[model samples]
Target: MIKGNLAGRMGRMGRMAGDSGPERVLVAASFANRVGNGLFNAASALYFTLVVGLPAAQVGAALTVAGVIGLFAGVPGGHLADRRGARPVMMAALAVQAVSMAALVLVESWAALTVVATVDQIAAGAGGAAWGALVVRVGGERPAVFRAKLRTFVNLGVVLGTVGAGLALAADTRGAYVVLILGNAASFALCAVLLLLLPRYPVLEAPPRRRRWPVVADRPFLAFTALYGAMGLQYPVVSLLLPIWISGHTEAPRWTVAALFAVNSLFCVLMQTGIGSRIESLHDGGLAFRTAGLLFLVSCPMMALAAYTPVWAAAGLVLAAVFVHSLGEVWESSAAFALGFGLAPDHAQGQYQGVFGLGFSAGQALAPAILTTVVLGLGATGWLLLAVLFAALGAVGPSLARWGARTRPQPAVAAEATG
Candidate 1:
């Protein structure tokens, strides 16, 4: 009796492990990629300003161009993915990224860096669509769980990557830039290898009739796309604006701000699954938007308080704000994924993802300038404006969601059968 119980327990554990599927492999790949990406992110600004000696404004301008390139590239990338298989498209994206990173390490001029950055951004967008679509293909019916699993994996990647980057930077921040570039290249190679192991699934190829722009004229789809674009604006505020704000206020060292950001990443890694589980039942788009709105509305005001507060107090407030922001991140991400994968017409899935990604690209392109103008030009006043903007935009999500809910139910998604 005892032996049987032990065997049963072991079998169940093994089954649970296997059920995670290709998710584990993807997670490992993402971890390596993020480490290299994180290293770049941690040091890139310094590299440009200190080593490359480019003006901050110029760097910003180049990023804006990169965003534009990424936006334009998304549709073509998706089309290519649909025409080719996701696996092939993904491998191509990785190869582009790897080559670009290697060139970046050797390049001496800002012009070359700008070109590489733009091309890399385009590759990123293409790769992103293929990856997300592939996940949907592999996930079968449990997409939410699958997405949650992937989110956790990505977050775990962020944590490890950030830690590794931090340590590398600490050793010799200036010398580490080359290593950062190399790290990113390594990730691409790793991802390419792992992708080969993923089960073969039907690829979305271009339609028989071509020679035209992809159409995304559906009203509900447009609305969803707009909401996603608006929400994407929040990322720059967090990444670019918030750090500057933290530096100006409070005597806390720079590392403190990095630590706070790290906390956000850590929570995303640990709590995503638990949080995702509870919200799985609330599939209504309107509810998801409302939830996101509440988080932004409640958290944005906390930013203004950072200037007046003590170090510990400021840290606490920032931590709370980050946590709230992450909740919205999870909900918005899940909602966006569901809408992109599930809501689009069966024949138009690739087009839907492409066009919607265009919206994201638009937001990404515009954010650096608009956000910088508001936050840097106006100071704390701009942050308040951002807060209001987030709240208002979040409010807009529900109306869009309601419209979607009222529309005819989207047809069930058919999983591609693996060969």
Candidate 2:
């Protein structure tokens, strides 16, 4: 009797632990990949300038060119995944990226850097599209839950990788750089192997061959995507703009920047899953997005307050702003995932996700110049303007999502062949 009771208890415990096959593998693989990426990102610029003997400007130019070119490949990548299968496409992309990372050792000049970077960026876009489709396949009906969980783990992995990268930076030798680079390549290889271990799901039936972009035809969905992308400006605001905003504009100490980022990362790791769980349907997701906008509106003006305060007071305000901004980030991410999976047609998931992703790309591309003009160029008034902008966009999200819900296309099946 006791043995049976213990066995039952163990089974229940396992369920509570949330142990599953495919989601586990996917999360583990994502962790490895993110860690590798963090390592590479931490060292790549210094590697290019010091070890590869290229100018910093040349490296930046190479990256910018690669990013721009890769942005256009998302749609084609999705198309390829739809025609083929997500697993195959993902594995192939992983293999290509692994090879690209390994090949970085051979780069010696600006030309070589440009070529290598371009290839790497293209593979990254394809891999990203494939991975999103795979989450849908593996998560079965609740891909957003799986995706949100995956993101949290990814953040944890990046943190660990960043710690490792700090060590590499301290070592700062050509040999050390080579090791980190190769470690990233090896990590991708491991990710590919892990992906193959997961059960492969069947592909959705492809639609009849068409030259036109179906995703483009979905106008309301496109608007939703664009709006979400605009919210993505928060990314640049934290990573790119904030440091400059602090040093150039605010009275906060420069060291507070690191502290602020730490808070953001920690908050995400701790709070994302909790916040993500509440976003289930399109309505819930839209509400979360609206909440995110309100948070942003409050955060920006609070951040503006930092500029007029004393050092400690400014730091306190910035810290508070960071916390508020991070909540919005979680909300935005949760909403995006729900909509990303919920709204996309099953047969055209890859293409839809790719197209939807353009909003993120567009937001990233546009934020720099736009923020520079208002936030930096105009100062406090500009900050207030940015706040209003976020409020307006977020306020409109629910309506746009409702419109999007109406526009979702019926899944187009591969027309059955006549006998």
241-328 in candidate 2: lDDT tens per residue? 7778899877888899899888888889888877887686677777888999899999999988888899889999999999999988
Pairs clashing within candidate 2 = none
Residue by residue across 1-419, what tens digits does model 1's lDDT show?
99999999988744432355576666666666776776677777777777777888888778777767787776777667666666688788988998887787666666777898888988888887776666666666655566676777677776677677777667765567778768878888888887887877776544567434444546877877887898787776567767877887655567766766776677677776655544432234456666776677666667667777888788778777877877777766666665555555433455567788888878877787887686668866776777777777767765665555445233321121120
TM-score, cand. 1 vs. native: 0.84
lDDT of 2 at 351: 84
True-structure lDDT of candidate 2 = 0.82
- The number of the candidate with the highest TM-score is 2
Number of clashing pairs, model 2?
0
Residue 215 C-alpha lDDT in model 2: 78
Cα-based lDDT for every prediction: 0.69, 0.82
Please give the clash total of every predicted structure, in order: 3, 0
Task: Give the runs in model 2 whose Cα sits over 4 Å from its true position.
Answer: 1-19, 206-212, 409-419
Q: What is the TM-score of each candidate against the true structure?
A: 0.84, 0.92
